[model samples]
Target: MRLQTAVLLALTLLVGAGVADRALAWPPDLMPADALPLKVALRAEAPAPKAKVSPVTGPAAACCAVLELRQYTLKPGQRDALIDLFDRYFRTGQEAAGLRVVGQFRDLDDPDRFVWLRGFPDMSARATGLAAFYGGPVWQAYREAANATMLDSDNVLLLRPAIAGSGFADVTPVPPPVMPSPAPLPPAPLPPGAPPAGHGMLVATLYYPFPAHDAAAAQDLADAFARDGAPVLVAAGGPVLAAFVTNPEPNNFPRLPVREGEAVFITFQAFADAAAYDRYRAHVGTPWWRGHVLKGAPEVRRLAPTSGSRWQGPF
Candidate 1:
């Protein structure tokens, strides 16, 4: 669910604005919309991944039992302002409302795109939590200022860990009591050369399989990643921080709509730097799962976390 409401919910996205500016091998299509086997949201059928790892323990272990992967499209040059307001005012308030702040990020490839993750213990918690946050004082005070800086905020995905031990770790479920007074608007940018925000190296690889031919095919591919692909990912450079599959649950909060009918296997990884990420990219020239999946490669996002994000990487 969105941490804050957009002030301008009625505005439509400019075609030349974002989604299309990115190159291929990205989601929502860098190629023509019809090129990929996974079209718009459709029923995705896959079993729980069989491969198991130790469950990730943190303050919000159950908080991330279900998750929201939100990507926002901002007006020109408004990204940083939104980031400032978001980093300063969003997390703690949302968490206090019984939701969890997972991580917040800047889409390294898209200047106008803001990506983030938040979660709840389960579907019931999600409904109760979202009602509290959106209906609470913090959002009401800053909603307009926060909304003024946006063009869109509806690109969202509902997800859960693909297997045990594959959800984000170190998430804080709530913050100590504090007032909702927002800091002055248009907050300052980080000092030049201050230690970069959390290594600034998170990559999300999203897999969109062709509609499941067999009930087991999708799960088989996910299982293959655990058995065969994850090990190679760690050895080459980055470590797989978490892995997620589409949360098949019905949308509990109708206020924020997630991408529907879409089945995706998303993985989060951390690298030392772009050089480290590039090295792994080059190493995967012949992907570990190349001959395994019938569909082409998945889309990738090179994301840098905001200063306030707890997911500052190397996790």
Candidate 2:
């Protein structure tokens, strides 16, 4: 997978592996009055001639160009209840309705937050699938239990892959092992053909209104990073797997909200372990662009994948 976005920050900000440097020039303020327009969304490519795969797998995932990056704020101590409800009951039912549960995770930085990704073939499928799943028997039956675990569920980002052929459509999903009942015991053994459950960490970085630069400057910066920054990240021991940008299209499914009117670019990376991630930080001395290029620092989340993910990148 290719993280097609966040080229600017990940590539530029190597200084200290995070945090802004407070001693640099603010370039955007010096620009001419007009803010040049930037092409925030990547162009969509034509599809291949293969037969459509229902419950799309790998190559068929291109069907789901539109994605939802949802982060929920849960009430303290309610995280386990929500995960149990989701792992056992929600995954299959949602898939059955034509949407894909791309992956789910526990935010290592914040124990009270749950993060998940949902995919749709397109905006139309998004509306259709969401309506069905939310109105279907499963959600109707368990909605109460699911809702009880959260204090807020509206922190969602509507996004799409940043480059051609770099979408989640390339991620092959495995059959999630669901519990027979909502019990606290460990999950049963994996059936044949499933990848062995493994351990690792995923880091997500967000570039939101990377303050100061005009649209044109931001786009130029992003392009530069895509070409030069990837190798730097790899050299630092973090393999960024996916890149995404905000979907400018209006929210067709108004019933479920998404973060609108905000400029966001994101990158997802995989690390072998916590220690490996630490080494990566030490390798990249401070990012030279931190204080000079972006006024506001991007948000980074170190994530732990949940077992119920239909797909969790190459990890």
Best by TM-score: 1
Could you estimate the TM-score for every candidate?
A: 0.73, 0.70
- 155-206: candidate 2 lDDT, tens digit per residue: 9999876654334443444233222233233333334442333256778887
lDDT of 1 at 173: 40
| lDDT, residue 130, model 1 | 87
Q: Which residue window of length 10 is worst by lDDT in model 2?
A: 15-24
lDDT, model 2, position 58? 29
**Candidate 1 weakest ten by summed lDDT:** 7-16
Model 1 lDDT, full chain set: 0.64
> Could you tell me the TM-score of candidate 2?
0.70
For residue 209, what is the lDDT in candidate 2? 48
